[model samples]
Target: MELGLEVAEGPAPYTVLAVKGEVDVYTAPRLREKLVELVSQGKHQIIVDLEGVDFLDSTGLGVLVGGLKRLRSNDGDLSLVCTQSRILKVFEITGLTKVFSIYDSVDGATAS
Candidate 1:
C-alpha cells in the first residue's frame, strides 16, 4: 500500500506531519522527502503523528532518525505520536524509544 502524508501547521511554530499506511523500503523515501522538504522550509520543530501507520521497518526508523538529526542540527526537534503496540514494539526493540520523544496523542506531542 502507498503511504499517505499530510502536512499541517500546529501550535505556534511547530509543523505536524501526519502519516498513514505502511512505511517500508518502498515508501520510506517519501517520508524522507517530506521531512527534508520541511527542514528545508526552515520548519525545525516537527511532530510526526504516526497513529495511522500499520507497519514500520528499519528503513522507516532510519528515516525518523535522520529527520531528528536534521532538525536537531538546526536547533529544532522532532516529536512522535504513536499508540500502536506493534509499532511501538519496533521502537522498543531498536532502543529508539530512548532516542525520540514519543507521545500517545498528537495533543500531548504538540503540548511538549
Candidate 2:
C-alpha cells in the first residue's frame, strides 16, 4: 500500500505528520527519510498520527522505533496517535507500546 503524509501545525513549533496507509518495509523507508530530514532541519518534536493506518508489520515498528531514537538523540520526542486494535496489538505484543508514547487521538498527541 502507498503512504500519505500531511503536515499540520501542532503545539508550539512541533509539526504533526499525519500518516495514512500501510507501513511496511517498502513504505517504512520513505517515512524514515522524511523524518530524518525533518530532524536534521531542527524540527525535532513530531507527532505521527497513525489513525488512518490500516496495517503495520515488524518493519513498520522498526521505523517508529528508529524515529524515536533519532528524536531522542536530538533532544526531541516522537509520539503516536493510533486507535487501531490490530495495530495496537502488535505494539503491545512487541512491547513497543511502552517505548513509543501513544495517545487515543491526533488531537491528544498534538496537545501533549
Among these predictions, the greatest TM-score belongs to 1
Q: Judged by lDDT, which candidate is best? A: 1
lDDT by residue for model 2 over 43-76, one digit each (tens)?
8999998888988889988888999999999899
Residue pairs with backbone atoms closer than 3 Å in model 2 (clashes): none
What is candidate 1's lDDT per residue for 46-99, written digit by digit as tens? 999999999999999999999999999999999999999999999999999999
Estimate every model's Cα lDDT from 0 to 1.
0.95, 0.87
Kindly report which residue stretches of model 2 are placed more than 4 angstroms away from their true locations once superposed: none
TM per prediction: 0.98, 0.93
